[model samples]
Target: MSNIHVYSEIGKLKKVLLHRPGNEIDGVIPQTMPRHLFDDIPWKKGAQREHDCFADILRKEGAEVVYIEDLFRKSFSQKGSREGFIKKFLDKHGIFNPHLREQLEAYLLCLSPEEMADKIMSGIKKSDLGPKKQEDFSRFFPEEEYEHYYTEPLANLYYTRDPGASIGRGMSFHCMEKLGRNLETVVWQHIFEHHPDFAKDAPMWLSNESHFGIEGGDIAVFSKDVIGIGCGLRTRPEAIEQLAGNILPQDTFKKILVFTIPKDRKFMHLDTVLTMIDHDKFTIHPGIEATLNVFEISLGGSGELVYKDQTDKVEKVLTKALNLDSVQVLRCADGSFIDSEREQWNDGTNTLAIAPGTVVTYSRNEVTNELLRRSGIKVLEMPCGELSRGRGGPRCMSMPLVREDI
Candidate 1:
């Protein structure tokens, strides 16, 4: 059995799951960006090409990359799993159309893995509901609401980092407040519970049932003893409390650092602000490190509460709390106002460390990329002009399952 407990940022990555952008990017119209938690829609073809390059880099690094669609199809193939999932979806959405359910099930069963994934993520259009009935069906069900009632499928499943999170052998799924994103969470639950490749007799923690909302983008493992959580638009404070209570005691982690992000569209997740690069050093946005607040959370004899106020600059607090004599905070852009502000808005600081001092980022953020290169870090840049238009970066593209702790 592989070690499922991921303890550090600099750890050697073994296996990770990534979803390359699909047709869903084309469906994200400009009008729906804010509602769908996106800034702008990207060109689908370009996004896919960039994501493919990112996947190739990870593959070259010898990390096992699992595609979300492939895993979902594998889970669907298991006896009773697809039916059970359909039932759950129906119950959750209050869809009682027996005929529709039967038809949908039959259609789903016939699809290939890639087709199923695309339809499930991008969704089948309501116009594809076939010919209308001749009879006045309204009288049979007076309360029936039928305009575009067929499931408006989740289009952001490619940003696999937003649905759930895992660390140190424990996993917790996010309870999506928006109904559009719920299907992705449902798929995540199915994968963790039934996928033979990952289940491995591992215990699971669900955030949906607990009323604690958290996303993978907001969670980061700095070291075995340290974790950084971002509290902002997506992740709530209660979720952090729940996470600390559940995971800390099991691994005996010394601290969980909480970084409070700006409650705006630009700074959506923690990854937008800080990401580790090497031992005792990190890439950061000055606004996040200098302007935002930080809190130290720990479980004492009574319960979870503030262990210390770390609102000082993130670098200063990190050095003091971790007891490191020196810590380097590389600016996301050279200390210039326009470059820093512009790049940070596009998630420039968000880089996923493949290994110690090695990371991947969006090539479009030239200033941030240059900064990283100057720091002696190997930067594998992927052209994310189309991808970044959707308001996520490299950190939002992948979910790490296992990494060795520093």
Candidate 2:
């Protein structure tokens, strides 16, 4: 019921949003897994159990958990609520032909609000919607071989962190580069713009119509006046500059540290390779610890961000930007190069800090979790056998909508 406020990544989380994997996971076939950005298909029942357990963990840690499905359902409770959302959902994906939109809308409206919401989240089969006279015949000369679902099941929606991020008292509905993920923003936009609880005062920083792309996993607000954004595979440097131009005039954050990392899928986002776990302590992957490109993004009087590329190392760059005396960096899977590579691939460097020193991570990363415990940090491990198939960890699965200001 309040405005979104997240000024620090390690602050005590107050409210968070997550999506419990449902029949949606069952919809991903082996043939379509790669196209949908999934490393492996997950068992639906087990995935739901894993997600429910994850939500319970957050709740026990004193955070209010809001399911994305529930939010959309609530937004649809009122009369005539489905009109705008349907239009937005269809148009955002370029399904603009009036006839095709009508068929989709009609199919969606027949069910109850909750069912309608679920159908959208679970995806739609082209066959289920019936033959569309409006269906494009130009591309079907040979008749597509695969059973193509009109709306791809968002198998990765469970990783809510990548689609959107919470900035200081606002939200950024990022324009994801992947075709499947672009729909995630459209779904959240409807909830934020129309849900009864958030409609009155939801502060949105970036629009869903943005051309340049920035995924939430790459952008982190470390403190009130200092922030860090990654320039990597999912998030381009141009998008970071555009985001800086949009955020600078607000003057809430004085400095933006652009950490450029390798574009390999192993280190797709900055948070995967680097994340702040406490005031002065950070979890790092050894692979990129010694090599990181650092740049300072700040406002110039000309209404654009003036970039100050730094020759200093990452630690020195952080110290300067965050005004820290000296920061401690803990490498993931310490000791063995092989173990480091293996553990980091399983998201060992990704930690969800509920409070300052207490965090949550996958238990499979034995060496990394032990390292976290040895560092005097509380480690809460969750079952990730089925959940990790989507290639996301605790931080990637949960998006803190509101957090206690540090």
User: Which residue pairs come into collision in candidate 1?
Assistant: 5-168, 5-169, 6-168
Tens-digit lDDT track for model 1 on 6-89? 777767677888887766656666566665667766677887888888888888988889888878777766777766876766
Candidate lDDT (C-alpha), each? 0.75, 0.84
**What's the TM-score of each model vs. the native?**
0.89, 0.94
TM-score: model 1 vs. ground truth:
0.89
**Cα deviation of 357 in candidate 2 (Å)?**
0.7
Number of the predicted model whose lDDT against the real structure is largest: 2
Q: Candidate 1 at residue 121, lDDT?
A: 71
For residues 1-406, could you state the per-residue lDDT of candidate 2 as single tens digits? Answer: 3558889999999999999987777778788887677788789888888888889989999999999889988887666779778887887778876766777888998888888888888888878787766465533443355756777677788889988888887778888977678888888888888888778765677887888888999988999998899988888777787777767677489879999888788888888999989988899898996668888888778766788989887777777777789887889897569999988888998899999999999989999999889988899999889988878789999899888988
